[model samples]
Target: MLSVMVVAATLFSVTTVMDSVETSIEKGTARLGADIMVVPAEAEAQAKTALLAGEPSTFYMDRSIEDKVRKVKGVKAVASQVFLKTAQYKCCSVGNMLLIGFDPKHDFTIMPWLSKELTRPLGTDEIIMGRGLTAYNVGSKIKFYGKYFEVVGMLEETGMKFIDNSVFMPYAAMKKLAEESKHKKGVKAANLPIDKISTVLVQVEPEISPQRVAIFIEHDIPGVKAIVSEQVISSVRKQLFVLLRSILSISIILWIMALLLIGVVFSMIVNERQREIGLLRAMGAKKSNIFRLIMTEASILSIMGGIVGIVLGGAFLYAFKGFIRSSLNIPYLWPSAAEYAVLVAGCLLLSFLTGAVAALWPAIRSMRMEPYEAIRRGE
Candidate 1:
């Protein structure tokens, strides 16, 4: 009985740990920026896919469109951003580095996240890189497709799927690289002139509805797609929660099945020990005392198993934290107090239930044992 309790408790702890790890990774991405996104009509499919899948993606947007967007009601602030495609730099290996071209002086929403790392707002010739570009640490000179530039700053680790693998620089820096590479190698940047940004980040007044603003933009503006941060995050969150719930459900079902097996095993043990139980009864032990002994053993086993499982689950969560975040396209935050409370409580409750359930049949059988027959078996 004790062994059965231990096994059931261990499985419960495993389920809790998995749940916490999944939640953490999803929340990390939400912390990096606003909830909304704007993409070019032509590139919306690719952008949405990348954002959800944690893969590299690029899109084009006309830089001139910002002026028109700013005029819309409820626009608190707007920042234009472009992501350059991956191409060979003069001296570096090929990897897609996000070239963010925004109004450095005016674009403070995303800039604050990069400020402490950068010497100053990026200049035409200077650039700040994502943690993914750590190879070009501060003071390292880098040449992108033949245009020479020095890495002035490296972004803090956000644990985000996309941000972790990106690099940012002034739009002009990218334009210069495109032009120079074209002149020298007779090739054009995937997208030229770079006047259009891939997306626009918008901040709206609290009193204004982002949904309303998005609707207005789509209706009033042409050649663009507008979506509020709330809309994007809500959509993403919904999908993630669905997955989390499914996992929880499966874990719960697994635990219940394990508990049933435990009960069956304990009942069988009781049958094999029928004579031993009858001997105790013959020795003047009360039926209640016999039941208590069995219950005590089951309880002890459950508590011990639960503790071991909790420790092992914690280790597993720590080891695979990064993989979970990257593969799921989410950020990872350590388990919080509330989450830990739930995990511990669930484990304890499940463990106790398994032990009690397992003892039920054995307890009843012991109560019914006859001392006369038990004594004969002992002989």
Candidate 2:
């Protein structure tokens, strides 16, 4: 029973964490809102890292790339975005945040969701906050690049750190900040080139293949690499599958060892209690009674062990979740209360069944033993 409990608890906890991480990654990728992202060749790796880590990164290519990409075959539309890094200071209510600039006319990524929040297009000084921006509320002002902007809307939770912790504003507002910072001595914003952009988002025509378009852009464009969204997501999924397979392999080994241990323990108990069983049978107890007694003992032990295991497992998962996520470098979201409860119940039931099945052979042996033969053997 104890072995079963330990193995079951470990398997449940590990599976839950892995599943949560995978789900978060899938949802984050889906919400990226671009078919293909065209970034400077030198910045391709950094861009992927920033997207996965949910951190702010700045890398730029000439604005002329947008025009070139727009002219590519099978291109439906193209938009340019810029990344601006802010500093953490006393005057700033929100800590360091990534400021993203998008063109309202050509943007299809954030504008769809942004439009749902606001009745009008984003003004030059107006901005939208990500869900993770807890420092300020709607209608509050945020200071960035030595300027103040009004927060007109807030994005819903997407579980992706990049989107959740970011601030979105108009491309014109980003340009204005760049111009203003040129005269502000010692400001980091002045270092950013006004005519450069961080990324180019492409929307391929419905009948056109995004991968083909991405390939075309990569081959035709110089100093830029185009990435298809599905390819990136597939790579992430493959990595996750490798990790999950290792976990399952370990879990299966432990489970089998547990079953064998439980079976051996039950067999030993039955042998030591042979005299007691014989006496009960001599007093007219039926074979079914002997079987029931052994099975009942197994069930009780299993239930107790399962209860303890579930509590311990839940505690461990809750306590070390942050450490686990950081160590794995994966985002995690805890299941809701109801889902956790179901998981707990399922683990307990599994443990109980395992214990009962492991004891089945021993119970049957005890039930079939003759009273006189069992007593003689015990003596």
Candidate 3:
């Protein structure tokens, strides 16, 4: 039973982890809804980290670059964003967070998720939070640098940590915050690069290929790199797949060993029960009845162990999910309730089969024993 529990838990954990990584990447990219991201030449890695892990990547270029990218062929629209980290400023009391300054008029990706009441233009002192910031409500005020901004709205969950962990406001609002930060008495100056932007999100013309447009952007614009959205997801997929495959291989080996141990353990139990089995046969119990009795006992034990294992495994995963994500610096989202139910059902079925199959030979031997001969072996 103990062996089965360990094996079951291990198998469940690996399968859940793999599924979560794949789902998160798919959902996260879909939420982005943009064809390409253009960033400073050396900040490509930083941009990926910001998207995947929600870690602030403090790099910027002049806001004028937005105009240049728009003029490039095949580019239909351009939106500029500025990134800042709470750790850089005097607002350390609010904890570390990502600040995103977006052009709401040009931002199709984020604007669509804004609450209905917030459809109007946002004020310079107002900000919209991501769904992941559940602790704060719409009326809550967050102090940035030395100024406080009211939370005017909260966006829906995107399954992407980058957007979830970020706070969004207009470009002018962020600029105003920066300008005001310098005047606060005795406060450490929190300067967001004035008149600068971080990354440019681009949407390509319908007839033009995203990859082709990305290439053209890089060629036309100096000191900037264009990243097709899929490439970022693909890179993470390759890295996670390799890691998950290795974990799954180890789990398969452990499960096989547990199966063999169950067989050996059940054989010893049948030997010890020969006296009782002989008496039952002497009383006219059918061989088939004895076989079923043994199998029924094994099945019960296996299922109980499986259930316990699942409970422990699930608790561990849920409790440490945040820590695991932070350490890995990867985007991770749990499967929906229905999908998770299926996984749990599959594990339970595997557990039952493992015990039933291992007990087969022992049950056959017990049923084959003659009443008189079996009684002698028992003595």
85-127: candidate 3 lDDT, tens digit per residue: 7754555446578889999879866777765456579999999
Q: Give model 1's TM-score versus the native structure.
A: 0.72
RMSD, one per candidate, in order: 5.0, 3.7, 3.6
Q: Can you list the residue pairs that collide in candidate 1?
A: 25-331, 35-229, 36-228, 36-229, 61-196, 61-197, 62-196, 63-195, 63-196
State the displacement of the C-alpha of residue 140, model 2, in Å, after optimal TM-score superposition.
3.9
lDDT of 1 by residue, 144-221 (tens): 565567777776655454665666777666777666676666343445444667787777667988788887777777
User: What lDDT, from 0 to 1, does candidate 2 have?
Assistant: 0.80
Candidate 3 C-alpha error for residue 146, in Å:
2.9
Position 287, candidate 1: lDDT: 87
Error of 3 at 286 (Å): 5.7
The lDDT values for all models are 0.64, 0.80, 0.84
What are the runs in model 3 whose C-alpha is more than 4 Å off? 62-77, 86-96, 114-117, 131-135, 156-161, 180-195, 203-213, 274-291, 318-322, 334-336, 363-379
Query: Candidate 2 — which residues are off by over 4 angstroms?
Result: 67-79, 88-96, 111-116, 183-192, 203-210, 237-244, 273-300, 337-346, 370-379
Candidate 3 has which clashing residue pairs, if any? none
Candidates by lDDT, descending order: 3, 2, 1
TM-score-based ranking: 3, 2, 1
